[model samples]
Target: MNVFGMGLPEMALIMVIALLVFGPKKLPEIGRSLGKAIRGFQDASKEFENQFKLEAQQIEQGLNTPTPSESEKIAPKEVATAEVATAESNNHATTSSQQS
Candidate 1:
């Protein structure tokens, strides 16, 4: 079997060296810790991928929705300004008639 681009013989040699460097008693503990670390990394990577996908979906939805044009955005403000100007002119006419 090839693992990390190493053939079976290379794997066997590395395993033998590891066993020699760390005795049989310590090997199981080291393997267990290594397994746990890999599991944790996998879990974290999955969570990050999920969050990224969720954010991308939200952005895509936002982009899909319609946005107001410049004129549409300005319309309500223009109407309100026109109403205010009319009210002010009416008030001035009333005051001038009262004074006359």
Candidate 2:
């Protein structure tokens, strides 16, 4: 069996090494520490995920909230002129493409 892509032989070898180094009595204590470390990592990861999700939601909400730009506060005539200029440039591109 592969545990997180570790083959059975690899796992067995690791266990054997651990047994030799720690002995049976200390193995349980090491295992407990390992379990706690894994759990702590999982908890921290979850909290980080939750925080990112919260920030994303806040950003989505801000996008929906209308904030008037400087242009929006400007005169309508200026906006119309800008739109016409953009449309002319777009038309020019389209004509160039069609000719090609």
Candidate 3:
């Protein structure tokens, strides 16, 4: 079977070389460690992918929802009217005192 672009013959050659270099006694231990390493890497990658997706969803929701500033924009005219009325009253009081 194809694995990392290496066919059956290539896999066999690599196994033979490893066996010759490391010997039979140490090979099983090495294989077990290698399997554990690969499993850990896969778990970490999946965790990172899930975390990324969750953050992206949160960001999307934040963008879609309206903020306080956006709601304030709709009622600014009433605030402006109140400000104008207060200013006019202040101007009238000042003029009346000056005339007296």
The top-ranked prediction according to lDDT is 1
- RMSD (Å) of each candidate, 1 decimal: 4.0, 16.5, 5.2
The sequence of per-residue lDDT tens digits that candidate 1 reaches over residues 43-84 is 999999999999999999999999999999999999999999
What are the per-residue Cα lDDT tens digits for candidate 2 across 16-93? 999999999999999999999999999999999999999999999999999988777786879789999999999999
Instruction: List clashing residue pairs in candidate 2.
Output: none
TM-score result, candidate 1: 0.71
lDDT order, best first, reads 1, 3, 2
Off by over 4 Å in 2: 68-100
Candidate 1 residue 57 C-alpha distance from true site, Å: 1.0
Q: Quote the lDDT for 36 in model 1.
A: 100
Better of 1 and 2 by TM-score: 1
Candidate 1: clashing pairs of residues: none
User: TM-scores across all candidates?
Assistant: 0.71, 0.64, 0.71
Give the Cα error of residue 28 in candidate 2, in Å.
Answer: 0.3
**Residue 94 miss distance in model 2 (angstroms):** 62
Point out where model 1 deviates above 4 Å: 76-100
Hey, what RMSD does candidate 3 come out at? 5.2
